[model samples]
Target: MALAWQGVRALARREWCSSWRQPAEWLTPLAFVIGVALMFPLGLGPEPARLRELAPGLLWIAALLASLLPLPRLFAADLADGSLEQWWLAPLPRPLAVALKLAVHWGWTGLPLVLLAPLLALAFGVDDAAPLALSLLLGTPVLTLLGGLGAALVLHARAGAGLLALLLLPLQVPVLVFGTAAAQGGNNAPVALLLLGAWLAVLLALAPWGIAATLSLMLD
Candidate 1:
């Protein structure tokens, strides 16, 4: 148990360190999240009323786009230098190892949006600020998990993260719809949170297999 926990932490730390070493990976997504969010006012005519109505959709879409930017690097970084082969042979369990990596990746990307959401909401004059941010906290995990799946799914492609996003973007629609619906102050926050969490949990269970499979195939 201790060994696995240590491995998970090390895995997370490794990803975090690599990301921080290249601040662009971290900064660019955040800049994009904030930038795409700012566009809401112009596209929707800038009325506070209009901004309030549209903020949820705007934030959700921007968040997903922000999440995609770092994904291709997920495995390719390790694979490029033959670290992936070493990962598969690690003493720690693979699923837990992958989960830790995803958790850190999302922490850098999705989790920050949760913390930074109020700014996003405030910029757009969104109401029910607490619920809007809360919904994001709960629902954005689905986006991260799907992003993890995409990272794993496209582990070997040329421009894998870019292609991964293209593939996963369509799969993201359901989360986007429900997540926005929840954030927009409606009758569905509880239901949406529950469903989104279920989605994340499902991905947590299944995504590693795809990642592991992709690694295994690369070996053979």
Candidate 2:
């Protein structure tokens, strides 16, 4: 257990340093989210009520799209540099390693989106940004986990980016629906939040193993 944690910390440190060096990897998605939020008011006109009504869906969609921008690079760097091969031979389990890496990936890519969501929600005229913020808090990690699986599956493909979006967007629909509903904060908001939490739990349980298996097959 101690050794596993040590490995996780080491992997976390390495990933953090790598992500820090490449500003665009983390920054582009943030910029995309902001751009999408800003564009809606221009396109839809400056009605706070209408914008507030639409804010939940628009913000969730932006977050969903922005999450994709960083995914292709998730495993590409490790795979290219032979770090994944070393991981295969390490004492740590592949699924655990995948989860750890995804956790770090979420820290760089998903965390910013979560942090920025409330501000975007306000910009969209949401009366209370708390529900939107709460929804994103539970939802972004799921996005990162699903994205990691998608990234691993398409890592070797020539047009992996396009394929990643295609594969991931459909799977993300449930999250989109529930997250938007939760952010909208109706009588059903609690239900939606619960469902979102359930989805997160389910994905966390399954995604790492799926990613690990996919990478193992690719490595073999």
Candidate 3:
């Protein structure tokens, strides 16, 4: 048991270091999210009320789109360097390893979006940004987990990034709907947040195994 935990820690450390070194991999997605948020005011005119009305959906959409930028490469580096095979062969359970990787992926990619959501919300003229931030907090993990699954499914496909987006967007609609509703803030916000939490819990229980299975198929 101790040995298994040690392996998990080692893999976690390695993923953290690897991701830390690649600033662009994480930063680009954040930049994209910010860019999209900024563009809305310009395109839609500087009407605060209109922007505020649209803020929840626009922010969620921007976050969703930005998330795609980092996912295609989630396993690509490990695969190219043979690290994935080594990890697969190790004693650590593949699902645990996948879960750790997805968590780390969320740390770098999804967390930033969640953190920056409030600032983007403010820019969209949202007076109380808490709902937006809260919604993103609950929802981004689902995006990352689902995205990890899509990334694994398309790892060897031609134009894998685009394929990952296409495969994932449909699967992400529920999250999008609930997340946007939560962000919009009102009587419906609590219910929307609850649904997002439920979705996150379900995906947390299932996505790692799904990703691991897809990866096993790829490696074989």
TM-score of 1: 0.91
lDDT of each residue in 92-211, candidate 3, tens digit only: 999999999989989998888878877898789888888998999999999999999989999999899878888999999989999999999889999999999999999999988998
Q: Which residue segments of model 2 deviate by more than 4 Å?
A: none
Best by lDDT: 3
Model 3, TM vs. native: 0.97
**Shift in Å, residue 89, candidate 2:** 1.9
When summed lDDT is taken over every stretch of 10 residues in candidate 2, the lowest stretch is 118-127
Over 1-220, each residue of candidate 2 has an lDDT whose tens digit, in order, gives 8987788888878888998999999899999999999999999998988999999999999999999998888899899999999888777899988998998888888888778776798788776888998999999998998899899999899999999999999999999999999999979899999998998999999999999999999888
| TM-scores for every predicted model | 0.91, 0.96, 0.97
Better of 2 and 3 by TM-score: 3
Best by TM-score: 3
* Candidate 1 least-lDDT 10 residues: 210-219
Clash number for candidate 1: 1
Give the local distance difference test score of model 2.
Answer: 0.90
